[model samples]
Target: MKVLVTGAAGFIGFYVSKVLLNKGHDVVGLDNINGYYDVNLKYARLHELGINKEAASNYNNVCKSTYSSHFTFVKMNLEDRSELPKLFETETFDVVCNLAAQAGVRYSLENPETYVDSNMVGFLNILECCRNYGVKHLVYASSSSVYGLNKKIPFSTDDAVDHPISLYAATKKSNELMAYTYSHLFKFPTTGLRFFTVYGPWGRPDMAMFLFTDAILKNQSIKVFNHGNMERDFTYIDDIVEGVVRIIEKPTTERVQNNELYKLYNIGNNNSVKLLDFIKEIETNLKMEAKKDMLPMQPGDVERTWANVDALIKDYGYRPNTSIKEGVKRFIDWFKMYYT
Candidate 1:
């Protein structure tokens, strides 16, 4: 199958593209490589996929990977209505895994327009392309943050996500709605996977796992938000990629829940680990204790998040079994190797 993986330079997107290429699928990776975090890290991810740094950093140019002949990459934004559609028309992608977006809840508070442009407007373009082209399945990245301030113990798909505290979450919720509409009107098959706190090697620098690990190694103080009173269903990277691959491979055969080929699932490790405990795991792996600076919860932040992945399990036999200890160890191992 020919697949178009948006945000292929991203952590999840990078891993997903590699997996698909190994499975003998033709993959075209797309990313603007914005300076949201670190462009070097993004470029390094592309480098791993055999893409040249010079070619990947350029705009609108397609670079064939030196790593895998089956993988090609384009440096472009999702909001580029002109270039995006041209690629779609040329590739005629069978499956589109739309993982591209301006991620980071706290960052959204500072830069709201970025969220709207990428997550909202950009998503509309993807829907338009999928509808226009003969794309079979459209699998997108949603967030557990959409659950917001809900007191529900285990956040489920049935739970009301009407109250998103952060602009990032709001845009994500908006994407789900937009997907539903496109499916209803044009009969486009779409799946939105509400990912929890995904962590592993090649992870984002802004995330808790990466932040804590970096600070600890440098003997710097790590910020513990909510005064060490937070819990997250931290799913491993491999498990998340597996679930996404399964959904992409198996297109929605029938209408789901009165909706025309629209499906949403919580792709997460069903277990929520306490923040302090998660920190302890990182400390254990690095063989060093982190200098902690307990802080109050920042605005646009939730106390806890726990995903009810029963639907994913039932539908796709999805099992996110990587423990916190193992995941942290693997990340630290990669961090040491990469940094050194």
Candidate 2:
């Protein structure tokens, strides 16, 4: 199948695109390559996908991959009104995996408009294109952050996510609502996967795993948020890509719930690991103790997140079995190679 993966240069998006290409699917990757964290990292991801950095950096131009003939990269933003529609009309994609968004819970506190433009307005554009172009399946990324400050031990898709702690989460929840409306009205299948704290090789620098590793390696002090009182369902990248690939192939039409073509599931490791334990794994892998700066929890941060992926397991036989120790070791190996 021909697939369009938005934010193809992104952490999850990059891995997802590579998996799709390996499966012999014709893939087109799109990203604006914004300077949110490091544009070089984004370019490096694209380069790994066989896209020329010079060609991919140019806006609105599509570059064929030197790595795989089945893969292509486009330098485009989701909010582009004119260009986005034209690309959709021209390509006529069968499935669209909308992974692009302005991510980060804490960053939303400072740059709220970026969330509005990318997550909300940009998602609307994706919905419209899917509706107009006769696309079959629309698989988009959602976040566990939508669970907000709920005291629920293991977050289920059935749990109430009405109260999002941050604008970033709010926009993700809004994406689900928008997709459901499109699914109900247009009769197109839309699936939203609520991802947990996904970490592995090529992970984002802003995330805990990368930050902690970088700080430790550089001999800088690492901030232990909430004074080492936090837990996360840190799902491995390979498991996430597998679950996503399965979901992409089996759209909502195959597994209809509540008579709606829209469905949601938590794509995460069911086991939640403590924050300090996670940090310890990094220290073990790097063989260096971190200078710890214990601090209060920042705003828009949750104390714990544990995913109940029973729905995903029941339907898709999705099981995330990667342990934190193994996952951290792999990440540290990649970090050392990439940064050294």
Candidate 3:
């Protein structure tokens, strides 16, 4: 199938695109390559996908990948009203995996407008294009952050996510609503995967795994939020990609809830690891102790997140079995190589 994967230069996006290409699917990747973290890292990811930095520097035009002829990438943003619609009309994609968004719980506190433009407005454009261009399946990236202050131990899709602490989570929840509207009205299948704390090789620099490794290697203090009281279902990147690929192939034909061809699942490791234990895994991998800075939990942060992926397991046989120790070791090895 021909697929258009937005945010293809992103951490998850990059890995997803590579997997799709390996499966012999024709993939057209799109990303604005914003300076949210490091543009160089984004470029490096694209480079690994066989997209030359020089060819991908331009917008609108598609750049073919040297690694796989089935893969191509476009330097474009979802908010580009004119260009985005034109691409949809031209490419006529069968499946669209919308992974692009301004991602960060804490950063949303600083730059709220970026969330509005990318997450909300940008998502609107995607829905419009999918509706108008006759796209079949629309799989989008939501977050576990939508669970917010819910007291639920293991978050299930049936649980109400009416309260979102941060602007970032609000926008992601809004995306689910918008996609549902499209799915109900246009009769197109849309699935929203609420991802957990995903970590692996080529992970985002802003993420905990990367930050902890970088700080430890640089001899800097790693901030232990909530005074070392936290838990996260840190899913491996490969598991996430596998779940996404399976979901993409199986679009919801039967209406599950609200009489819409829409479904939502928690794509995460069922086991929630403690924050300090996670940090200890990093230290163990590096063979060095970290200078710890035990601090109060920042706003828009949750104390714990545990995903009940039983729905995913029941339907798709999705099982995330990567342990924190093994995941951290893989991430640290990549970090050391990439940095030095």
Q: What is the TM-score of candidate 1?
A: 0.98
lDDT agreement with native, every candidate? 0.92, 0.92, 0.92
lDDT of 3 at 295: 97
The TM-score obtained by model 2 is 0.98
Q: Candidate 2, residue 167: CA error in Å?
A: 0.5
Off by over 4 Å in 2: 251-258
In model 1, pairs of residues that clash are: 50-67
Candidate 3's residue-wise lDDT over 206-320, tens digit each?
Answer: 9999898899989999999999999999999988999999987765555533465888999999988899999989999899999999999999999999999999998898778
- Stretches > 4 Å off in candidate 3: 251-260
lDDT of 2 by residue, 233-258 (tens): 99999999999999897755544455
The stretch of ten residues in a row with the least summed lDDT in candidate 2 is: 251-260
lDDT tens digits, residues 1-340, model 1? 9999999999999999999999999999999999999889999999999999998878999999998889999999899999999999999899999999999999998999999999999999999999999888899999999999999889999999999999999999999999999888888789999999999999999999999999998999999998999998999999999999988887565555455598899988998899999999999998999999999999988988888989998889877889888888899999999988
TM-score of each: 0.98, 0.98, 0.97
